[model samples]
Target: MKIAILVEGATERAFKKKLCEFLQSHLGQKMPRLHFITQDGPIPKERKLKKLVETLLDNNGYHAVIALTDVYTGKPDFKDANDAKEKMRIWVDNNPNFYPHTASHDFEAWLLPYWTTIQKLAKHNLSAPSGSGSPETVNHQKPPSYWIKEIFRTGKRGKDYNKVIDGMAILKNNDLMIAINACPELKAFVYRIISLCEEDKIIS
Candidate 1:
């Protein structure tokens, strides 16, 4: 199977690479041919996503297309995460082959609930305290990237957190089940991917 993922930027690209690996390994399925979207075109920010999806679907090779963008990226039309997702859903027009998932505030919010897992994986003390409340509610004040950097900077070794390197490492090494349970948005995205795999007979 082939799947195209339209992500906001490099951080998301890294995250999706790890996520695809996790899904393939855990579900015992052959990994899909994954395509990452780029921003080299002249399309406007708001319309760029739809254009990418349309282009991917037009190729006729991809079985599924998923768009992942952060809610806090300042899309003027969206009032909040739900608004952004709803707009994308309408734009997708009930197409089964296309799915839209938004990371509330930012993608890093998904990591807040797994502080202990991160600490263990990095073998360093995290400076940020464990957050509480719903995933969106808990860390809406700052981007997850900021918090992660702070955690690494204040650790015993005082290392800097590289989004592409350390972020992907943390994601790969951490407990997938724990992350799925803690983050509702992530759970929804993963569930959709699993369902798609099942529907395609890639996994039973």
Candidate 2:
């Protein structure tokens, strides 16, 4: 089956290759073809979002369309993961073929789990983000993106964090499962995709 996933800009589109490889580890030969469509930012809201989903679903060639958005999008788009999903569900009229997923706060939270790798790549000794210590728990007051950018800015070598470049380099050698296990929103995101592919649901 062919699936269309609406994602948050260049970083996610670039990360699609790693996602498919991770899914293939479980779904194997049954992995569905995934197309990551970048929105250049967060996915649209309300009627615009509904129209986007409907248009993708309207194509018989696609079995489903999933939307992936971040909770803390710099502007108050969603209160949290559940709020985002519920609102999207309402906007899409609870269509079975349309699924919505979120990166709590933002995608950079996933990268936080690999802080050891980040430190090496950044050439900085800056400690991991302070909080409850859980990546997802890194609240929106500052958010993961803020921490990431801060590290890159002050680090001896990092200088800057390109969402598409440094983000990938940080996660490139790491397993997606690490982030999924550490972040509830990430788990739900992977769960939706794997379950739709008829693969084992990740329980962590």
Best by TM-score: 2
Query: Per-prediction RMSD in angstroms?
Result: 3.6, 1.7
Worst 10 residues of 2 by lDDT: 195-204
Score each candidate by Cα lDDT.
0.67, 0.84
Clashing pairs in 2: none
Worst 10 residues of 1 by lDDT: 38-47
Question: After superposing candidate 2, which stretches have Cα over 4 Å from the reference?
Answer: 199-204
Clashes of each: 0, 0
lDDT score of residue 125 within candidate 2: 82
- lDDT string for model 1 (1-204, tens) is 788767767676667767877787756755566777744221124465566576778866788888776777644555676887777867756566778787776777777776775676555775554453355544445657666777676666556777677677777777666667777888877777777666554322
CA lDDT for candidate 1: 0.67
**Model 2 per-residue lDDT tens digits across residues 154-202:** 9899468888888879888998888888888878778888888785555
